[model samples]
Target: MSEITPADFALFLLASGDMQPRKRARDQQADLAGLELKRHVLDLIVSYAPPADALEATLMQIAQEIGPPYGPTRALCASIRDEFADAASTPGFMEWLIEEAVRENAGQKEKRRGKTFNQ
Candidate 1:
């Protein structure tokens, strides 16, 4: 199984609202169990109601720890941090996130296929 990274966690958070249904969808199937564990950890932090800056710091720390291929870049982490709250409160934000994740995943899969074929 592929290791989940901070980017995956952030994507999970952004799409969490529809996770259950997405998990059941064939094309959307992913390591939901692993993502759930990450979600639980995030929930623990959120329960403390950390200030925005602190929350962003914590997220950046996670990204650094998970650095590289799957890990998000500092810019991506900042974007995710800035958008996290709106993802929960803004209508349709979750849908947009899910769609973006799917699109990105599809593109990555295609790249992998190309690499394999070329090799």
Candidate 2:
């Protein structure tokens, strides 16, 4: 594998925001999943950026990287919909908008479930 330079790693950290760790620390195997998800998001955002001009190309890349969100990722997105909703209106925020919708539907369904007891 090609070695990653510190500058590249720094850029990744910048792109990933709060997802990747900032300092060296003991990490578990399960931690890899979150890191991977962050990287996937970063990749999509970068690819979708205006200068890149490759939304179509990045869509395929994102699909290959993330596939359809599965159990945990779907659940995570659903749980954190409020946090992501602000970004939904951004130009390249389609995927996140989808997740926001997922979370919205999930929340609406939950509310309906609660109302069913009253009715």
Candidate 3:
């Protein structure tokens, strides 16, 4: 099997929001790979996010806050987590994240209201 680069792994971690300020910079060397960082971060949030089940509940609450589509994704989770299932911290949270991504994309296609038509 081809080894994954630390840069790539860190990119994936950043994508998932699992990265710490120092750790991100430390992953520059292409040697420290093989570990999934995103799931690690998600687990941290799930276990330590103050109030049990905060991620799941926050997702829904933010969905309501952002007000549909855009609400849940950014308003709720901030970024989408691909491996929510393997996260082991909270189950099914990734589903909500992806579902919101789809919804948010759909919502973006609708266009915002503010353009005055030129005669």
Question: Which candidate comes out best when scored by lDDT?
Answer: 1
Screening candidate 2 with a backbone cut-off below 3 angstroms (N, C-alpha, C), the clashing residue pairs are none
Write the residue-wise lDDT of candidate 2 on 7-109 in tens digits.
2322444333355345657765567676666555544455455222333344345455566655555544333333333333355444443455556667768
lDDT of candidate 3 vs native?
0.39
**What tens-digit string does per-residue lDDT give for candidate 3 at 21-57?**
3355455543232133334334445434434334455
**Model 1 TM-score (2 dp):** 0.39
Candidate 2 deviant stretches above 4 angstroms: 1-17, 22-27, 49-65, 76-81, 86-119
Total clashes for model 2: 0
Rank the models by lDDT, top first: 1, 2, 3
The lDDT values for all models are 0.55, 0.47, 0.39
Off by over 4 Å in 1: 1-9, 13-81
Better of 1 and 2 by lDDT: 1
Per TM-score, the best of the predicted structures is: 1
